[model samples]
Target: MRLIEKVWFRGHPAKWLLVPLLLPLTLLFYFISALRRALFTVGLKKSVTLTAPVIVVGNIGIGGNGKTPMVIYLVELTRQLGFKPGVISRGYGGNAPHYPYLLKEDTSANIAGDEPVLIHQRCQVPVAVGSNRIASAQLLIEQGCNVIISDDGLQHYRLARALELIVVDAKRLFGNGFLLPAGPLREGRWRLNKSDLVIFNGSPNTELWPRKLTTPNAIMQLTAKVVCNIKTGERITLSTFVQNNPQVNAIAGIGDPQRFFDTLSAQQLCLNNTQSFVDHHAFCLDDFSHFNDNIPLLMTEKDAVKCYGFSQAHWWYLPVDTRFSAIEQQKITELLITKLAV
Candidate 1:
C-alpha cells in the first residue's frame, strides 16, 4: 500500500508523536466549527435570506453521499410543482476564481466544476458556482430563479437556507465516526437532528444515535435507480447489460467508487476489472491505453467531462437519475413552500 494509505489505515508513529503538539490546533478547529454553528443558532451570525426558498442538500461526511443525485431529484420535483429551480455550488474542484459566475453551456468542467456542469446539463436549469454560496444564490435570484437548490453546503453556515436535507451513504454511514483528522466526519452525527429530512442513499440504518428522520409527518424510504451510458444519451437497463455481457470494465471517479461498483454488481453485471480514481479525476488519452479497442469502457458522468476531447470510441458514461416516492416528494414540496412563505 502507498505510504499515505498505510498511514490512513494505521496512524504513523510520527503522527501520534505530533498529536500532542497538534492537539491545540485540532481543538481550535473544533471550536471554530462549533462557534459558527452556535452563532447561526443564536442569530449572531446573519444568514442571507434569498427572495426565493433555498433548499440545501449536503452531508456531514467529508466525501460524497449521493448529494448530486439528490439535488437533481429535488430540481425535478420542484419543476413538477411549477417552480423554477436554480442551483448554486461552491465549485469544490473548479478553476473559476469568481465569487459568482453564471454557468453557460460552454462552461468547462475545469471552470465550473464537474458537478455544476453535470447539474446544468441534466436539470436544464440556471447554475452558478463560486466560493461564496450566498453570492451565488443572490446571482441565481437575479436571474429570476424562485427556488434555489444548493448542491453541497451543509457546513457552509453563511448561506441562509429555508430547508436542509442531509444525505447519508447508508452503506458507510460514518467511517470510524471520529471528527476531522481523527476520522471522516465534518460535523457530529448529532447534527442530523437539525436537518429537515435525512435521506439514506443505500439502505436505511436507524440504529445510530440521533435515530431516523421520523419526526411528526416525516418521510423515509430507499430511493434506487439503475445506471446508463451518456454517450448515446440513453438509459441502458442494468438487467439488459448483465444478461448480454458476463464481464465488463467498470470505471468510477466519484467520492465512493465502491458504491457504484457494488450497485452494478447488485444488478448482476459481472465486472472483470475495475479502476477507481480520485473524485473529479480528469481522464486523458493515456488513461485509456489500458483497454483494448474492442473492450467497453464505462465511467460516471462526472468523468465524462474531462474525456470529451478524447478520440476513444469505446468510452461511455453511465448517467444515473434518482427516484423518490410520492409522499417524500410531497413533503419536500410543502417544506419548500413553507420556507418561501416566510
Candidate 2:
C-alpha cells in the first residue's frame, strides 16, 4: 500500500510525519480552492444554468465515496418518477480526442471512462463526458434529457445545480480534517453544510465528521448479488459461485479496495488472495499474466470494464447495487419533487 493511502485510510501514526512538509502546500491548495469558490459566488466566474434540474452527487474528499452507485440509484428513482434523466461526468482517465463525447452502448471504457460507460450500461440512460461539465450537460440536454445527473460535481460550481447530494465514506470521512496533502479533504468539512442532503456511503462513524455534518440524511449500503464472467457475460449467485470456485484471487482498482473486500467477506466469498491498484489504473494484458487459469480471478464491476477485451473466462466481476431504507428513499424522492417541482 502507498504511504499516502496509509495516512488517508489506515490511520498510520508514523505516516503522518509528512504533515509538516505538506502543510504549506495544503495551505496553498486551500487558498486557491477558496478563491475559486469566491469568484463563482461574486459573479466573477459565471455559472451555466441548464433548463433541466441538475442534481449533483459528489463528495467533499478526493476519492470515490460511492458516487457512481448513487448516480445510478438517482437515475432509477428519477425514471420511476416519470423523468428522463441523463448523466454527465468529468471522464477521469479517459483520453477521448473530442470534447463533450456522448457515450454509446459500444463506447470503449478507455474513451468514455469506466464509470460513465458503466453508468450508461447499467442505467440505460444517456451519458456524456468531458472535462467541462457544462459542455457535457449541454450535450445531454441536446439529446432530450429532461433532468441532468452530474456524476461528481459538488465543487464544480460552473454548472448551477438544483440539488446537491454529498456522499462521504463513513469510515474514512475526511481523514485528519485537513486539506489536500496534509489530509484527504478536497475542501473543508464545513462544505457539507452547503449540500442539500449529506449521505454516508456506509454506516456512519460519528468520530470522523464534525458534530453537525455527522447527521446524514440517509445511509447507503452496497449489496453484492451475483458474480458475472466479464468475457462471457454469465452470472451466478455468490453461493453458486463459491460452489465452483471456492478460493479465488480477488483484485480491485477502486478508491476503496478494502471496502470491496469487506463487502465480499460479508457475502461469504472465500478470497484466497487479493490485490489493489490505484483508482482508474489502466490495465493491460500483462497485468494478469501471473494468474493461472485454474484460479478464478474476482473483481468489481468498475474494474471489469477495462479488462473485458483481453480477460479470460476465469475472470469474474461481482456486480453490486446500492441499497437504502424505503423511508430514506421516500424522503429523497419527496425532496427531489419539491425542489424540481416535477
lDDT of 2 by residue, 137-239 (tens): 9888999999999999888998999999999888777777778887888888888888889888889865664356543479988887688999999988888
Tens-digit per-residue lDDT, 23-122, candidate 1: 5765777898998889988999887776888899988876667889888888987888788899999887788857698998888888888899999988
Candidate No. with top TM-score = 2
Lowest lDDT sum, 10 consecutive residues, model 1, at: 1-10
Question: Which candidate gets the maximum lDDT versus the true structure?
Answer: 2
RMSD of each: 3.4, 1.5
* Predictions in order: lDDT: 0.75, 0.87
Off by over 4 Å in 1: 1-25, 210-236
The alpha-carbon deviation from the true structure for residue 169 of candidate 2, after best TM-score superposition, in angstroms, is 0.8
